[model samples]
Target: MTQKVLVTSIFLHAGGEVDHLLRAEGFEPTYAPALTKRTEDELIGLLDGVSGAIIANEPFTDRVLAAAPDLKVISRTGVGFDSIDVAAATQRGVVVCNTPNVNRYAVAEWTLAMMLGCARHAVKNWTEMNAGGFKRFEGTELYGKTLGLAGLGGIGKEVARRAHAFGMTLLAVEEYQDQAFAAQYGVTYVDLETALEQSDFLSLHLPLNAQTRHLINAERLARMKPSACLINTARGGVVDTVALAQALREGTIAAAALDVFEEEPLPADSHLHALENLLMSPHVGGVTTEARQMSGVRAAENLILALKGQAPASPVNPEVIPTARYAVSAT
Candidate 1:
């Protein structure tokens, strides 16, 4: 029987390179691009005989997994696994993998861009200038500012490295500490409260989990300096959208720039759209051309490896691989 691999990410292999790579690996590839919104039923239908998949933000719930008994591996094109039911995947002995390191620099750079955009009123000033106005929009400089990082993972570390070059002091709230790295980067590992209070620009780089979801609420917003700006290039659920809207409305914080939101394609009637202090992007922080190509290749490689009964380089559920139905034998 020929092994089948489904490609669900809209942009994956759009350039033909990853498709060629998949074909070169002697696997039959099914292309079902979810250009707009993909329903759960659509995903279940696509998983008919698929042994592996390269997916985007599509939800692979327990029901969906139960429907696809042939699904042995799911290789995500990005770092987030929140859309997928990881616990269910583990229980079902389905290997879950993600493309990490590849997009960190891109996301980190986008975070910096958003931070600077908020600090310098880039969009507001440009709008005013284009609308026949001048000398009305003043901007703040990043020099000698305090930047707080909520998480210091790959992307957070890259953000710190760039921010350091701008002569900004760094403060972080990370579970694990690397003293040597902190010393080299001049970063002070502080409690979340202190990081919030002292930061001129607070950036979030946390993953979306139960503990991290809505971690930044109204109270946390109130703790931040009234003149400070918030930047989130991380998962949308990390901050409370309702509270952020209110905070921006009441000047609890001076401004915010977000690439991700709780509800993607941010609803047309959302209050966030009405807040001028909030800048929004449609979660394209990791969608650069280079990132897309790298992510696609990495995800394809992971899927191929998992299906070939080999261990994937970046498995989110490594514990499941040992007893997986497709586990490679140790020779």
Candidate 2:
């Protein structure tokens, strides 16, 4: 019996490369593009009899996992796996993997772009110019400004490199500090509070977890300088949306540019839409052409290896490998 694999991410099959890879591995491929709004019922229905899947930002709750007993592996096309319940997957002996390094530059570049855009009032200036009006908005220069990083992972490191090139001072807060890296990059290791209070621009690169969810709350936002700008390309739930909207509205912070939001599609009736100091993108921070292609290839490889009972390149839940019932035989 040929094992089946579901390809749920729209970008994974972009050039049909992932499908080709699945075929080469003797796995039947099913295409059910979720387009970033996958419901639990939809995922359950699509996952029936699927041994593996390439998912995007779909939520895989414990209930959803219970419905798909045949699912042995889940390979995410991007680094962020917050949408998937890893603990539930691990308990079920399902291997979870993600493509991480592929999108570091893409997300880092988007972060810097948003930072510069917010600093220079790029969107507002262009909008006013197009509306048959002349409004000269004086903008701040990025050079000589302090950039605070919430995490110093791959994406954060890339951002630091670019920020340094632009002559920006760096401050960072990371759970695992690399003293050598900080010294080489001239990044000052500081506490979260100090980073927020002293930064002219704060960029979030942390993951969304129990401890990190709503990490940037009202109290932390209050600690930031009124002239500071916040940039988030990491995860939406990392920052409290209500607190951020309130901050932007009351000038608690000067501005914010977000590539991710707590509620995706950012509800049409959301208060964030009315704020002029806020810049929003439809979460395309890591959607560059090169990044997408690389991630697609990596995700496919992960699924194929896991289904074959071989170890995946980057398993998010490696603890399950030892006890996984479907693990590939070591030949």
Candidate 3:
């Protein structure tokens, strides 16, 4: 007689809604044993009787959905639902939702930090200092530098707002460019070429779609100012890793910082390891403690609502939600 929630991703903390929902007044829940491609297969097995689920960035392939006929809702841990086949889920009458607006600050702050770190050679300096040596390092100051933001969505706007406080000139590229929005951010709307040519620092905030895949390839990298630094907190494949490495080797640009890569868990033999001017972090732009807890708790709230026969605020496919089993009952 008890309802269960299945978690398909590894969480930073276990005490969030996973624990809360399971031990709460009238709910039962279970977290997937581990997070791996194999775990996803196991999740499909566990999901047979589960009413709801909380998942991470792994691909929820159509095969997985075919196994969960009783599923009522899916709560994505982050803002992106691209990994999940939303159309397939919708056709199967499953409600899919995500936790939005939770990780914007974490990612925005990390993007700016990477920009500064690359400019100042922070990682290289630390490496030398830890090796017990005195070293001289040259670095550029951010004030009055031009920054080109490739996307002007929530995360991009936050980066722009903070960059303004540092007196940085901002140029942005958005498919949905609005002069009014640009004015509010104190940014000028520019074409990609213009922004690349003039920017001292380039930060990407776009998603990985057909038009954006390998967006920063050899030709585009060639357009950047020789002294410019590139920062990407957006999805991998947005910048071509091989092209970037070539640019760094030839000093086509000053330096590059990336929180995401063309491949996740960047391969052990990856050439990026040999680039002195490259600053890298494990695709953790949004992996702060606050973001983790917020994602978990927010996912739980949305899942709970859907399970209780109510509408969730951030359903990926709103139309599907209305026709889903739980939504029909709630309505």
Ordered from best to worst TM-score, the candidate numbers read 2, 1, 3
RMSD in Å for all candidates: 2.1, 1.8, 2.5
* Candidate numbers, best lDDT first, in rank order: 2, 1, 3
lDDT of 2 by residue, 11-94 (tens): 665348888888877788888887657789988999998889898888899999999999999999999899889999999999
Distance from true location, Cα of 208 in model 2, Å: 0.2
Q: Give the runs in model 3 whose Cα sits over 4 Å from its true position.
A: 12-18, 22-25, 33-40, 178-181, 327-331
Error of 1 at 7 (Å): 0.6
TM-score per candidate: 0.96, 0.97, 0.91
Residue-pair clashes, model 2:
1
Better of 1 and 2 by lDDT: 2
Q: Tell me the lDDT of model 3 at 152.
A: 90
Each prediction's total of clashing residue pairs, residues at least 3 apart in sequence or on different chains, is 0, 1, 0
Candidate 3 yields a Cα-based lDDT of 0.83
Best by lDDT: 2
Q: Which clashing pairs does model 3 show?
A: none
